[model samples]
Target: MEPRGVVLVAAGGMDGRGAMSVLYIYPGKMRGNGLDLVARQHLQALSEAGVKVECLARGAVSMPGITCRFLRHTPANALSFLPAAYYYGAQSRFFGAWACRLLDPGRHRLVVAFEGAAGRVFRRARASGVATALICPMGHVGASGSRAELAWPAIGEERLEEEYAAADRILVRSRRAAETFIQRGVREERMVVVPGGVDEEAFHPAQVRTPGPFRLLFCGRLSERKGIRQVVAAWKEAALSPEQAELWLAGSEPNEMKAWLDAACGAGVVRLGFVNDVASVMRQCDAQILLSEAEGMPKSLVEGACSGLATITTSEAGFPVQDGVTGWTVRREDSGGTARVIRQMADDVEAVRRMGASARQEALRHYTWAAFRKAFREGLLPLRQSAD
Candidate 1:
């Protein structure tokens, strides 16, 4: 079946530089993040498939190939409430519906919600007979409640439930997340598991640094849920003397984690806050560590694996890494167990190299963008036909 057209509404900003025809709708101004990269990749894939694509953001600065549209009202927080509020608001809902209505009838066949907040618009589109899908990075609900939710009680579970029920299809990053949606009232068949993909060309072993000290790297927001504190504590417990290995953290630290870093009293841990050149850091590191309490399929794991780094991640990461083969999978809350694993890997240079090699091989075999594009097309095909 030929696709009419697809509209992607994401809380995250759009970065579709090249596409035959693509339209990306952001909840607020676009910022550089995982979503932006994914948007760019999506456009590239769709363009290669001979689809036309255009991109726009509510409050985004214009990029090279994507068009930017501004929404008068600002969203609360792109990560949390703002998108939810937009999804529920009458004005945003009406605006989206009207926009979709104006799109040449039969020209566009599907509307995809990139994040939860985009649900209302997509729901309205579906109500208007357009096929709808929600592309969630971490799933419909946050597995572990976010810091924003904890700090502000206003972001309730009820709103999330509403978003879950509204979508025609829920695109998730892992089987675990698909299960989460099933529990949240979405039918099993309505959910699709399209694991996140890595740009092998950009994040490959060739870019990594070689012949260096066993550098341990941790990338992601240094927040409690990300388990940055646990990782730091584990490193301390492992007690690798200065010459053995060093911990390199490349991400923005949350305020709560700052005190932990100040109290740690160690020079071995290097905190490089929010570095854009992540590939460089990945290359320098011998292993990548992610102790997140909850995740969808983390991009870091894919990138780390692609870059030939032995990854130490939590079960929440949801990547199909074989235990003792591709990388080490540790329990989310068990710092002691995690530390033991890291120490063991660090102690054996040959074992670390072997794991890194396997990790790279696994990434190349399964996590490439080409694989993801094929899966995405297959997953959406049935729904597209049903919409017809």
Candidate 2:
């Protein structure tokens, strides 16, 4: 492990510079995004653990012993929704496919990268007799079918499949994602399940619940897939007036949801777009809901749970939230079921607090960032390399 060298071709984040002679190839413009934050955390962990990392990011970031390089520039318009997939997909593909040419796999033990973004980088890595890996963060593309939650372009599917085929191993965040791949003909031995982790220190319980209206926090894109529209509908459907519950929508405001939101939330909704300090917001709320139709372990749920917010999530989210213990799980997206649960929680504030407390306490021991990093390192470290 000490002598091995690794090269990373990243379209998004998760800088894989660990205890090895590693080189990172990533978009320079990536910062302040969820994926960027994750990359920073893991990169820091790898450094603290004594891995020698060299980074080729688009922007300027200062780190000790980590060499930072630039990609000149890449045009990305976060505001344009219709062309977002094409723009970002092409950007990542260009960044990933060409980034690795600067990296010589003959000098590295491994070359790892995101699916679709890797372009021909993995093929080149394989040609050099290097072990190639792809971080398959999502489920299969065939299953996505224009689902709002998948968040990638259909055009990138062919490239992703090719990269998967080229990689020696493909990494996934949950057993659910692995199952999706296996069902799609990917070998079980080729997949690794490394669950998501929360930064417990950053998302701890509030010192005291602030005196305010009963609040339910909803963080993530306010789309149908995230169950935002459903939550709003249920809020009205449950007949719980604004005095009973307040919904805070934090994240980008999708144009498609604004019309329905006005009718459902009215004065009861609080919108905070692109919040820099999510932990503080979590402290102000009573509970969190992420009744997503599908997901690869929503980080917002984990962050909320770590912050002692009672989680009202769906089983499709892939987290083990107990029915009434750690948190409540809604089986259906129908407004009535959600409303009923909301009404019950609103009536019993103490129960919500208790469940929230349990969420953080259990997470600190089991789902914290420390836990994730340990699992991540174990899964990332190759057995053959470890024996060295």
Candidate 3:
């Protein structure tokens, strides 16, 4: 049976139409970040499945067939922003609630909250008779390296816990993440593990490998928590001949780490600031390296797999690639070990090709957008029906 109404609240907005209109509320400005990409994919997939999607954001936005509303209120004056220290702490929640009431007067049958900040709004929606689900990316609750930029002393750990307890259902990206939520007191049955999907068409392997000095690519922010220093040390230890292999670091560098990165660059490390076409760069590289301290299933790993590049990441990445099967999973702090793996892949062209082939096969079989949509529908359909 069709759900009576459906709403999706997240930290990023979506733009598309579906059978049941989905309201997506994002916490920040719509940018080219990983969260934005995931939200876009969800909206696009839902639209393809014939569901209408609406988006709410604080800044610049565009959505087709879905309503795009920008809330103008600041968090300081907004009564709903909890603990009230954040710039938009109170206002975002109040405005979100108001927006929900305005857009969904009768209340949505199903409301999915995507981030911790959206929890209060979801609870309000539930109180108004909307069945709500909370969607949290893997590693969200865990204090990790990537969130340094987003950390808020005002929100605090207790507030995060309160939000988690309030959600009716929690959506996670991996088994590890689900475990984290369960440990936090969310019932096991209330948690759903749905990984982000990959764009196969855009990130597939080239018919032929691009010619270059065996390129080793790392595409993510250069933050200490991301293990950039570990990656650099590993690369240095691996000591691939300049003629044989070169390390390529792509994406923005944190301000605090700029001097360190500059020093590395002066010593011949190649760091390319954010690029428009990551796929093109992935195609040119032989392998993708990610030594993150933690992850909720990074898109880069899947992209690497789709592009037929061997991936060398930590266990936290949560990709299905097994050690020596599809790709390699190195210890988080073992830069020396990771470096050895990189050196081996750089030296053995045949091995790298074989691993790359396996990685692409895995991506095709398990990580496509269609597969993700199917899983998402299956996971949420029962709850949506029950709520109706």
Position 201, candidate 2: lDDT = 78
Clashes of 1: 12
Best by TM-score: 2
Count clashing residue pairs in model 3.
Answer: 10
Candidate 3 structure, TM-score to reference: 0.81
lDDT of 2 by residue, 256-285 (tens): 777776666676778787677999999999
lDDT of 3 at 17: 35
TM-scores of all models? 0.79, 0.83, 0.81
RMSD to true structure for each model, in Å: 6.6, 5.8, 6.2
Tell me model 3's lDDT, rounded to 2 decimals: 0.68
lDDT of 1 by residue, 193-219 (tens): 877888777776653356755788888
Per-residue accuracy of model 3 over 1-388 as CA lDDT, tens digit each: 1112223343234332324445566655556657766666655555555555456655434444445555434443434444334555444454445445544624356665556456556666667766666667746466543333444533445555665776667777877678766776678998888886888999988788777777888888787756788888888888777788888899888888998877665333688988789999888888888877656787788888899988888876666567887778888788788888988888887788789889999888888878887777667667766766
Backbone clashes in model 2, listed as residue pairs: 14-39, 18-51, 19-51, 28-58, 28-59
Ranking by TM-score: 2, 3, 1
